[model samples]
Target chain A: MAHVGGPVRAWRDYTDGAPPPMLQAALDCFVEHGYHGTKIRTVAARVGLSVPGLYHHYPSKHALLVSIVQFAMRDLLDRCESALAEAGPAVEDRFRLLIECLVLFHAHRSDLAFIAASEIRSLEGEARSEHIAARDRQQRMVDEIIDAGVAVGAFGTEYPHEASLAIVTMCTGVAQWYRLDGALTPEELAVRYDTLARRALA
Target chain B: MAHVGGPVRAWRDYTDGAPPPMLQAALDCFVEHGYHGTKIRTVAARVGLSVPGLYHHYPSKHALLVSIVQFAMRDLLDRCESALAEAGPAVEDRFRLLIECLVLFHAHRSDLAFIAASEIRSLEGEARSEHIAARDRQQRMVDEIIDAGVAVGAFGTEYPHEASLAIVTMCTGVAQWYRLDGALTPEELAVRYDTLARRALA
Candidate 1:
């Protein structure tokens, strides 16, 4: 189920063109202590800057969180797009690619994944709506993949939408407990997840 | 893969007594705002008791958290034991039974699951070690099941431990996002999850 033939890139490599250090630091702190528990000083300290300096980059703590969330959402969508493009003509291949991308994303950017999965409720107004839309889009991608698989008779499930939710939930949950120092590398972890995802739909 | 059995009573239900109301209130507060973010006054307010009155039951906020964690861990292990005993001989049936028990456990006692998953690290000394041991024991149960499945040639996986971790992580994550008013009941959710789990191992 692992995607063959690909140029792997680290998260930092992807962010070099337009880095958001303050947002990244804020996300790390938020993932560690949650939104309400994280303080501006802690975020600033993580970036080796003063609170005022961090504020100069982000207007407020809430603003920092909002920016971080938006950033992660956009990043996830971009990865999804790439996976869709790289995935071959086979529906099963596309499905496997999507799950592998999700696991890889969670394993690599766990701090961002944690916030994306858990902290959207803390956002307000347009920010919250935008994040929700992005989340729905991601969910829709899973739905579409399952629908395609079902159409091709490659997957067997009574409820496609619920199966999609279970698959996505199982993949996203990787962020909570996965460690960089664990037994498997991110790529290897993604392969294992791909197998589980395939089995889930089979 | 559904377990063919009636509902099994958990240790908590068969125990001699209920927990102190104060501790229940504390668990609710901790689940809502988290441990570091929760205040004694807030718990007191929720319970309709003075701060001093609340302290009469538990000496400190940390003490309340410790009590909640201990209760949750003990209850979870007891439930797992009962589910295993009731599941009978089939590996798939046992796995489904365990998943059903966990889904019901998380549905009725989400606060406890949340506290056990998130706040246990805050505990110190023997309290912390005790919680860690319980968590490890739970992981071991899943590990043993997967190992048995592999030995019997009923499950095919290159990485059983990783697969087990994925399954446990997925089930535990339901507590973080599932709502009572959602489209599925706890039983429905369990069935859906069992399907996904079976696919994952197929």
Candidate 2:
């Protein structure tokens, strides 16, 4: 029952905390082995703990997946929101900052970002709802920015909603390929995507 | 042993075949329950066969994943390459056509597309190599188009490689969120992204 439903949250508050170190370890293991291929025991061992001890941290493998997604989205939204707030009154300025926020997040904390996008299907019940809400919350930011821009003639699109999705999709993909050792640093990647985003809307 | 080493294939050709009907069945199960979550038995049963029958079709779950990704990529590459070939000499025309092909493929064959992008890490050895090669071949098409565009002063980007990757990444995310019943049709989405892509590069 994963991948159905749309709901919005308050959107006013999202945590900016780095995912706990265990989440990082679990993210690593999940990336190496598909969620089904990964054993909970392996995650624990990676963190220098036993399987039982791992349960003490998370009740089940599903819980781990849920927590990973929650924190990842939360982290992403927090970054985007802050960036949006920091940028000045102009919609284009805010739009440019949002792209920078997204590309840099994907480039910098790629593993967590990877799980955030790929592991949504594994989420169940409230976890799925909560995660989707966080995603929609992020999408809503893009939608609002675009909508606002369209209203003021700052942006022009016959398909404003799809434009938002395309922007997020494009920015999110940075995680799939970005590497610390890669040719372009996160700052550089963000700059390039920023240029692309401007051209897309212009 | 997943995610290792790259090799080039004879990239002389690619075809856009309708994925076999059987692929649809497998893609469903994989989406509901990721590669590891799916069972050979369940997949076979879905097709009204014994586990052994499924084994006759695919040697292992990993094999199943490899086939899915290869076919899905083939389908995508087929579409993108054809569009790239068909659009007139202008880089902008080719680029616009390329966006339409990608957006449409991801919108229509979303489940398979999801598995194709998300399940790459589950493959190992030659399977992984083959799939990445197919992907690189597709990326090479984008790179060539962008390089030619820049060479001819049709497209202007300081970072050609990152722009290509970002374009693919943005276009690919349509699968994760698109619905046939959603507000925008594939054609509409493509038109919108085309505008965005042009602006980004302009």
- The C-alpha lDDT values of all candidates are 0.77, 0.77
Candidate 1 at B134: error in angstroms?
A: 1.9
> Model 1, range B104-184, lDDT digits (tens) per residue?
677667667867776654687898898889888987888888888888888888788888888887788778668879998
> What is the C-alpha lDDT profile of model 1 across A71-130, one tens digit per residue?
888888887877777776789878877887888777777778766665665788999898
Clashing pairs in 1: A199-B199, A200-B199
Native interface contacts retained, candidate 1: 0.57
- Clash pairs, candidate 2, are A170-B170, A196-B200, A199-B199, A199-B200, A200-B196, A200-B199, A200-B200
User: Candidate 2, residues A96-121: lDDT per residue as tens digits?
Assistant: 88887888777777888777777787
Give the lDDT of residue B115 in candidate 1: 72
Mind giving the per-residue lDDT tens digits that candidate 2 earns over B126-174?
Answer: 9888888988887787788889888998888777788888788888788
Q: Could you tally the backbone clashes for each prediction?
A: 2, 7
Off by over 4 Å in 1: A1-19, B1-7, B11-20
Error of 1 at A47 (Å): 3.2
What's model 1's lDDT at A16? 43
Best candidate, lDDT: 1
